[model samples]
Target: MSELSVTTRSGPNGPVVEVAGELDHDTASEVRALLSGLELRPGTQLVVDLTALTFCDSSGITVLLAARNHVLAAQAGMALSGVPDRVQRVFRILGLDQVFVTYPTVEDAVAAWPQQTE
Candidate 1:
């Protein structure tokens, strides 16, 4: 079993959460709790960095979806960065690739955020 770790940081777009772990059923609730505890201001663009994630199970996928819903409920934006190729393949296989917006890096995700309207 791989250990789970999540680090949160403030960024120009919003709060960026860097996740490193094997996200399986055993660890998904912890991740979900971390996400649930966040208070995103309106329009904040949340980015989840998954570059160090080694594995993700269905429960992990559910947690990710929950994160997305949380952002939406707060009227904020959310995206995933640094998704591993295997994870991407799994998402595609599950037809979840279309449900998520992912980028190659944090910078890319930040750059793609919708500019604040004047």
Candidate 2:
């Protein structure tokens, strides 16, 4: 299995977390911790870019849900971008596709992020 890596970058609306490689039970905690530590503002959006994700398991999905919950608890929005087709299918089967907003690319998600009202 490929080693999982989670990296964060500043986004137009907030922070972007890019996850690469295999996301399974072994590495889910790493991602969960990082997400839990983010400082988000009410109008900001947390973008999780999974473009380079090679694989994901149930634990990975749980971490994703946790990320969503973290953002919501902070009064921020969350989106998933560049989700692999395999994972997309699983999301659909689990009805998570309805729970999470998704974009075909990171750029698209950023463009669609709602602007903060002054």
Total clashes for model 2: 0
**Model 2, residue 96: C-alpha shift (Å):** 0.3
Report clash pairs, candidate 2: none
TM, every model: 0.93, 0.94
Model 2 spans > 4 angstroms off: 115-118
Query: TM-score for model 2?
Result: 0.94
lDDT value for model 2: 0.91
* Candidate 2 C-alpha error for residue 72, in Å: 0.5
lDDT (Cα) of model 1: 0.89
lDDT by residue (tens digit), candidate 1, 1-118: 5698999999897899999989999899899999988999887898999999989988999999999889888999888999999999998998878888899999998998875211
Tens-place lDDT per residue, model 2, 25-87, is: 889989999999999989899999999999999999999999999898899999999999999
